[model samples]
Target: MKAPAISLLAGLLFGAGLAVSGMADPARVRAFLDLFGAWDPMLAFVMAGALMPMTIAWLVQQRMPRPIACEAFDLPGTGLLDAKLLLGAILFGIGWGIGGLCPGPALADLAIAPSEAGIFVVAMLAGMTAHRITRG
Candidate 1:
């Protein structure tokens, strides 16, 4: 169908998957990330499980007649790991560690824990705005 419809369905399905997998729960995510503190490995298994399907999906996409969106593939052709890229990754890791929530988890949190999600989203937006202002 239309791009908007496809995007909406994809987002709904992704949110549903996040909810079903307990990614929305910041506590659980934090516990998982705290390898030295709690040493939980279930999250690793969950991530591997998620990756397997995506790996098969990639294989299928390679054999498809054409892209689902009917557009030419415009995959990034960059392998350059510049300073800016490294710094951004460091910042992202710090934020994730501090909040125990990233884009996917933040979106999923809207259904079960709106207050925390709202805070995370607002902060994320503010950071983006601040970066734009500072960069310009």
Candidate 2:
């Protein structure tokens, strides 16, 4: 119960940050990726801002036995590079580049622009399903 509530609160804060940072806007993200064209550096700033807190959290996690809301940290164990990881990363990059809407931003955009965001979210879900089916 506590873990779920904490997760929900964290998600809400993340979504709010995305919205406030203009990261939920596909055009803004697209512009950031357009290095040779009308490039925008706002995303870099947002990334830096996000990185700071995450870095601190990771450092804190190292000193703590477990999270306050959970028995374990639930962090990923693997740091190994593999074909599957590479392929998934490539696919994710392709999708992000083409649509300018990654999962977080796309999910956040759903409330502001349902039609566009819905299409992206549905496609993303389909990709996730395909990956799961193929993995097994």
Candidate 3:
């Protein structure tokens, strides 16, 4: 119960932050990705802001005996950059470049532009399902 409630609150906060930061707008994200063309620097600031807190969180995580709402931290297993990782990253980058909305931004856009974002979310779920079937 505690974990589920905390998860919901965290998700809501994340969506609200994305909405407030203009990341919910696919056009804004596209503008940021357009480096040689009409590049926007606002998203860089937002990324830096996120990284600062995440850096602090990582430091804090090291000292904590256990996670607040879980028995242990579910951290990544390995740091190895392998073929599967590279392929997934390429696919994700291509999707983001063509669609201008990755998972987080797409989820954030759902409340504001349901029809468009819903299509994206459904497609994303389909891709995830395919991956699970193929990989597992």
Put down candidate 2 lDDT per residue, 4-118, tens digits, no spaces.
9998999999899999999999999999999999999999999988888899988998999878987787777868998888988999988998999999999999989999999
Give lDDT per model, in order: 0.83, 0.92, 0.92
Tell me the spans in candidate 3 whose CA falls farther than 4 Å from its real position. Answer: none
Instruction: Residues 36-130, candidate 3: write the lDDT tens digits.
Output: 99999999999888998899999999999999999999997778898999999999988887788999989988889999999989999999999
Ranking by lDDT: 3, 2, 1
Candidate 1: tens digits of C-alpha lDDT, residues 37-73? 9856767788889998999988998888777775765
Clashing pairs in 3: none
TM-score of each: 0.88, 0.94, 0.94
Worst 10 residues of 2 by lDDT: 70-79
Residue 95, candidate 2: how far off, in angstroms? 0.5
